[model samples]
Target: MLPSCFRNICKNSVLPKKTFGGAFSKNNFATEATFETKPYRLHKLDTSPSTTVTINREDAIKFYTQMNTIRRIETAAGNLYKDKIIRGFCHLYSGQEAVAVGIKAALRPHDGVITAYRAHGWSYIMGVSPLGVLAELCGRQKGCAKGKGGSMHMYSDNFYGGNGIVGAQVPLGVGIALAARYKGTDGVCVALYGDGAANQGQVFEVYNMAKLWNLPCIFVCENNGYGMGTSSERAAASTNYYSRGDYIPGIWVDGMDVLAVRECFRFSVDYAGSGKGPLVIEAATYRYSGHSMSDPGTSYRTRDEIQEVRQTRDPITSFKEKIISANLVTADEIKKIDGEIRSQVDEATKQAKIDAEIGLDELPADVYSQSLEPKIRNVDPFKPLVHKRLGAAVNI
Candidate 1:
C-alpha cells in the first residue's frame, strides 16, 4: 500500500481516453468563453470584483495544463517522500493548485509572490522548472537552489520563496511590496500565509503598518480548514480571516475555482495599485495531505472527509470538467496532456535521483556574496571549511 499521506491522490489524474470522431473538431475553440464565478464576499466595500470571468481557449489550455502539472508534481513528491528519496518537511500542494495558478494568471511577471512552506506550485508558476524543483527536493546539484535549500526554501525571480517559519514570510512580502512601491513600479507583492498563521501577532501588526503606509501588498490567508494537527475551528477564534483585516479591505474567494481566484487577484492588484493600501484575501481552499510529509493527514480529518473533498471540491478535477464541458478542448486532448505531464514528472524524478549531491568540500558554498573571513571553522577547527563561489547568486 502507498503511504497514507498520498491516499486518494491520483498521480496521473488522467481524463478517460475517448475518440472525438471529429464531432466537435469544427468548434475546437471559441474566441472566448465567459463563465460566472462563485460570488465574492466583500468586506468594507459595497461592490465586488466581477463574478464573470472571460477566458479564451489559450487561457483554458494554460490553466488546465499548469494545474494538472502541479498536481502531478506534488503527487510525485509525495511518492518520493514515501520511498525516502525526498526527505524532511515535504508539504504537498495537491489540492491548492488553483490558488497559485490563478494568482499567477492575473499577475504581471515582475509582481512579487511569497508563500508558506507548501510552495512547490508557486515555485513552478514563478518560473522554476519541474526538474529544478524535484532536484532541489532530492538534494541534487541541478536543483533550483543548487541543492542547498530543500522543500521549503526555493527562490525565483520576483519570488521571495517559501519561508519555513509560520508567519515570517508576511513581513518579507510586505517589504517586497514596499520596495516596488519605493521604486514607483506598478508591481504588487502577494504575501500568502495559512489559516494557522492568521492569528500571528505579526500579521495584524503588518496589516496596520501596510494600511498606514498604504503599501501595495496583497496579504492572503490560505485557509485550508485544518492547519497542521488542528482544524481552523479549534485553532482560530474566528475563521473569518478575510474580515479580520478590520481597516483593510478584504475579499473572500472560492479558492477551489481557478477563475474565481484569478478575479480576486485581479481585483486585489487593481485595488492595491490604486493607492488603496493593502487588501486581505482569504482563499478558502483545502489540502489533501497533512500539514507536512510526516503527518498522516487522516488523524485530524476523516478519510471520508478527504475523499469527499477530492470528489467534490478538487481544484484540478473541477476545472478539468469546466473546460471540457465548455469545449475549449476535447477529452482526448486532455488525456494526451495528462500523459505528457506524467512523462515529464517521471523523467524529472529519474533525473533528480541520478543527479549528484554537492560534496562535503562544497558545504560552505553559496552562504554569502563576500566573506570577511577566508574559512568557516567547523567543530573540528583543523579542517576549516573554505567557502566556494561556484556560480551566480540566482540558481533558477
Candidate 2:
C-alpha cells in the first residue's frame, strides 16, 4: 500500500539497511541480529536478559540438534506407549523442547535441575542420553533409573528424580539450594513444575521459605496452556504465574523461542548464582500431548488449536525456521541433523525394546548407592518397603 516512490525505494534497496549492525551485506541479510523472536515481560527486576542471544554456527547446530532430538524422543515415547511397549503413566515433552534445551545450553555443571513427571526432555538435557530415557520408558535395565523407575522417575548426575508428586519437588529444590549455600558452592537449583501444580499449597510455602532463607532456587512454572484436560482459566484464578511470586522476583519468557528461553536462563543463572535468593519464571509454553498417556490431548481442546500452535508456535519448527531465515545454517544442514536424529532415535528405541528388565536379585542391589555396603553400615532399605504378603512373591 505504499506510494510508488517508497515502493521503488524498497524494491531497489536504495534505503540504507543501517538499523541492524551495519548496512545489510550484498546478500541483503545481516550476518547477525538481536531482538529476534518474542519479547519477555519482567516483574520486580531492574535488568533483563540480553535482548540479543548468541547466534553462531556452533550454537545454531547444537540448538537444532538437541531440541529436535528431544522432540523425536517424545514422539517415539508416544508411539511406544501406544504400542504397549511402555507402560504406566507416560508424559511426553513434544511441544516444550525449547525450555529444556535452552536451559541446557545455559546451564553450568554445578547447577542442578529437578522436575516433575514431564521429564523426558529435562532428563536428556540434564545428562541422561536419549537411549537412557527411552530405555527407562521401556522398562529396560539400561534406563537412567535402571528400569526400576519407569516414565515418572529418571535421574542423573546433578539431576534429581522425575518426581511423581505434583508440587513436591519445589521443596526439594529449596533443599538442594540450601545445600549449595551450606557447602559454600555457588550452585543454583532449577526446579520445574506444571501450571496444575502451581496452585499447590506446598509450592507457596517453599516459595516463602526460599525467599526467607535466601536460597538460590529458580522455581519455573511451565504454563503449557492446559493442565491436563482442564484449561488454566478453570484451574487458577490468576494465570500470570510469573508474578505469582510477589516477594520473590519473577520473569516471563516465550518458552517457544529457544533463544529467548536460553537468555532467560542465562540471566537467571547469573542472578540466582550471585546469592539473589529465589526466582520465579513462568515459561509460557504449550503441550501437544495430553498431561499423560491416559488423557487424550484432544478431549478439551480442539484439533485446530493444536494444529495452529504446531504451525505457528512450535518450538522446534519455529526455531528451525528462524535459524534458516537468519542464514546461521542452511536447510540442508537442518535436514542432515533431522536424518541423524531419526537414525539415533530408531537405534535407541531398538535397544530399549531389546534390553532386559532388572532381575529380582538386582532389585536389592541399588537399595543404597554402590558406595554404601549394606552389611557393614547395617542399614535397612533407605526407601521404605511395605511388604504385603501376596502369596510370598519371592524369597530374597
Candidate 3:
C-alpha cells in the first residue's frame, strides 16, 4: 500500500479525462476559444521607488474584486465545514488570497497553473465559479470535479489541480512546459508547491530537467513559514527557498502583498516566455488554517503568533488600506464589492448543498481499464467455437 499521506493523491491522480460540471463547467474544458499566445516580460515586484508601477482605479478594482471573491468563497467554505455541510479533508486558502490574485493578474487564460492542496484561492481567480468549488467541497455532481474530487483535486481549463502530493507537480509542470515549447507556443507554466514540499526530492529533480530542457516554467514556492504546523526554521536547513534553484535565477518575494506577488510573477512570466529557461520565485506566504481543517493551527504556533501575522500582514486588508490611502478606491466601493462577494458566496453554498452528490459508481468509471467479464460458477461460461476447436488440438 502507498503511504497514508499519498494514498488519496494516488487515487485522485487517476481521474478520467472527462469534463467537470457546474457554473464554471461551461468553459472548463479547452475548446476553440482558448487564450492566444502573447509574449510578455517578467518584472520583479520591488518595494523600491524606482521599481514601482502605477495602477489606475479600474485595475485596482479588478484585482480587489478577484481577491475579495477568493476570500469570501474560502470564508464560506470554512463556515460550511464547521456546519458539517462539507466533509473530508478541507484545506482553506484564507491567508494566501493575495498570492493567487497577484500571480493570476500576470497570466492569460492559455498559461497553465498548478498549485498545492491549499488551492481554493487559485481556482477562484482562474474563473472557476464559487458555486463550482463549493459544490466540489459539498461532493455534489455540480462540482468542478463532478462531485468526485473533494478539496484537493480541483481542475479547470489550463488549471491542473489542487494536487495533494507535495512536490509531484514539479515534474508534471516541466512536462507541460516542454509540450508548449514543442508546439512553439509562448505559453508558460506556473507550478506552485508549499514550503513543506520544497524539501521533496522530486522538486529538485524537476528543477534539473527544466533547466536542461530550457522549459518555460516558473516554479513558485509558497513558503508560508510552517509546513503542516512545523516551522520552516525547524523543517528546512536553509530558509531561503528562492536560492534552492542553483542553476536558475531565483527571486525572493514578499507574498503577503498582492502588488509584490504580481510584480514578481509578471517578471517571471516575461523572463520564461522570452525563452530564457525556467525561473524560480519563492513567495514567502502563510496559511491561516491548520494543515488540513482537522489540526488547530494554534497548537504548534501560538495564538499570538497567528494574530500578529493577521494584524501586521493580512494581504487583503493591507491592499485595501493601500488602495484607500492612495485614493484608488473609496470605502463605499470596497463595501459594495464586499457585499457582492458575500451574496455570491451565500448563493453558491445554498446551491452546492442542494445539488446531488456523486456516488461510488463514479469511482470505477474514471479509471483507465475495466474488468472484462463477470465470473459465473453455477453454469459453464459461453465458449467461442473457434477458441474451443483450436484449444482442443493445440494447448499452448
Best by lDDT: 1
Model 1 gets an lDDT of: 0.83
Give the clash count for each candidate.
0, 0, 7
Any idea how many clashes model 1 has? 0
Candidate 3 wrong stretches, greater than 4 Å: 1-50, 359-396
The CA-based lDDT of model 3 is what?
Answer: 0.74
Q: Across residues 85-204, which tens digit of lDDT does each residue of candidate 1 receive?
A: 998889999888999999999898778999989989999989999999999999998999888889999988888887899999999899999999999888899999998899899999
For all candidates in order, the CA lDDT equals 0.83, 0.82, 0.74
TM-score of each: 0.87, 0.88, 0.80
Model 2: residue 345 alpha-carbon error in angstroms:
0.5
lDDT score at residue 320, model 2, on the 0-100 scale: 78
Writing each residue's lDDT as its tens digit, candidate 3 over 1-396 gives: 211112222232321122212222242322211111111112332322113444555677888888788878888888889999888888988888878888988997779998888878787778788999999888898888887788998888888888888788888888889888999999999999988999999999998999898899999888777788787777888867777888777876667767667766777788799898998887766777888889888777777666767886677887787666555567888999999889989999999989986654344344322445563221222321223555552212
Of models 1 and 3, which has the larger TM-score?
1
Best by TM-score: 2
